[model samples]
Target: MGFFKQVFKSVFKNIIDLSRPIFTFENNELKFKINSEYYYTFALNNYETKTRHDSYILEAYTINSDNLFVEYVHVDNDVTWNGLASSFFVNLFKEKLPINSMKIIEKKEFEHYEFITYKINDEFTLNFIYIYEINKDNFIIEKNAELYINLLQSFQKDYKYKFDKNQDLEFDINISIVKENALNGYFNLSN
Candidate 1:
């Protein structure tokens, strides 16, 4: 009877584990935190290339269908992040993208945080910021208070861009952030 009870408990535990979500999001001050069972998988799935080492993993993915790329780094040390970000910007200067206009509008570095803003075009802008010495446990916070504001103008527009057939054709379009990491790096789509 004891053996049967043990087996049942094991089966129940496995069932619960299988139902867990892959990724969860929590809002920070002005940014967001992405937590996942397989953070590496989540990073690799979105990026075109990856640089892995014992201390850190750096992955870069392109947005706007390969028109623009951003490199994100996951490291325990602050120095590693600073080095990677510097190298990335240096490379950007050497090899300019095919975009019509690209320029760095602002760059700032503080004791605990650093950020760079790039103006891609007249309509879009890209901002990258890193904060150090942050509390990893307090991942979520909420505060609501409205200040006096004025509405200048508001409008909504929709546009679609077509991609070439050979470029990223095998990518999964309906990938769920919560489900992808649960697969344990076994991506079904063929590349």
Candidate 2:
């Protein structure tokens, strides 16, 4: 009975592994290709910030070689400041995608959060933009202004995204602080 159980477990593990997508990174480009018609690539450029932090900017391009599909920028900061602002923007941009599937493709210790890329369709790919914040005495304050520009002549003007019922896609910027022993306060921009 024990021998049979071990055999079954090995077979199950192989099946699960075969169902996952394959990712590859070579020559400074990270790529995932499902077929000729479906794929995404990130062209990464890294530089040093004036403050001496390592920074990178990634441009996500589509299969047909549309260069300006989307852009993501990140600055390597301590873990405490890394993901706070990016999470908010990620939640906002995710609402714009059809989001067939999403997974974390890469994560680094010096990076703020896991690098997540979403598969919107065969031709569209999106990634998150990460910025940092400082927390002191269990309190943190952040201020940001975002300006979006459309550079494509073929951009859709009437496209709309339908979100899942359980998905919260609302964008209400606010301040939230969490301490080890207590909750600070939430300041909602809407109110």
Candidate 3:
């Protein structure tokens, strides 16, 4: 009976999310809390790169895709939540600057959300991350990527210009498909 219970528990855990909501929408604003465990797990794995830059895969995939831990993620890291976010900005900015001068300008981790600012160049203030986190019995989900993409898609909010990451990306037409659904009740997005 114990064995059966363990198997069922494992199966059910994957089927249903018995934790905080991964994506939340309300009011005229949308917020996201990236999953720390998923970020750590993805960082823990190893992979082969198609470029010489150590962070090529990590930066490119995370930027190209709408989510960070998408199927294209094929990189590794040894930093915590803040550290990885830090690296993501560093590698991102370094792409254009290519200057070996990256430093932490500021770091603020609140009870729910956190921000890590990096000074990779003269205009470092532009390259910062004010993101949220999701914790499920200490388990992490891939909400950060979702928020990043959604923020840029639904909100037209992005920092690609600051780092010159996608400076050449020209959206000739307004093909952005956004679904504006009214949230039913008050959702205390205090995770």
**Better structure of 2 and 3 per lDDT:** 3
Q: Which ten residues in a row have the lowest lDDT in candidate 1?
A: 145-154
Better of 1 and 3 by lDDT: 3
Candidate 3 residue pairs in clash (backbone atoms < 3 Å): 34-144
Residues 1-191 of candidate 1 have per-residue lDDT tens digits of: 99999999999887765544322222311222222121211111222332223222222122211222323323332322222334344344334434466566555554334444555444344444433332111111001100000000000013121211122222222211112223333112222
Candidate 1: give the clashing pairs: none
Q: 27-50 in candidate 2: lDDT tens per residue? A: 655444333344345553441111
Q: Please name the candidate that would achieve the greatest TM-score relative to the true structure.
A: 3
Query: What are the RMSD figures for all models against the true structure?
Result: 16.2, 16.5, 16.5
Once model 1 is optimally superposed onto the true structure by TM-score, how far is the C-alpha of residue 132 displaced, in angstroms? Answer: 5.4
Global local distance difference test of model 3: 0.31
Query: What are the Cα lDDT values of the candidates?
Result: 0.30, 0.29, 0.31
- Put down candidate 3 lDDT per residue, 45-153, tens digits, no spaces: 2322122122212322122222122211222343123234434433533543444675765454544444444444453332233433332101111223323333333
Which candidate number would show the highest lDDT if scored against the true structure? Answer: 3
Segments in model 3 whose C-alpha atoms lie over 4 Å from true places = 1-18, 22-30, 33-89, 92-97, 130-191
Off by over 4 Å in 2: 1-84, 111-115, 121-125, 135-191
In candidate 2, clashing pairs total: 0
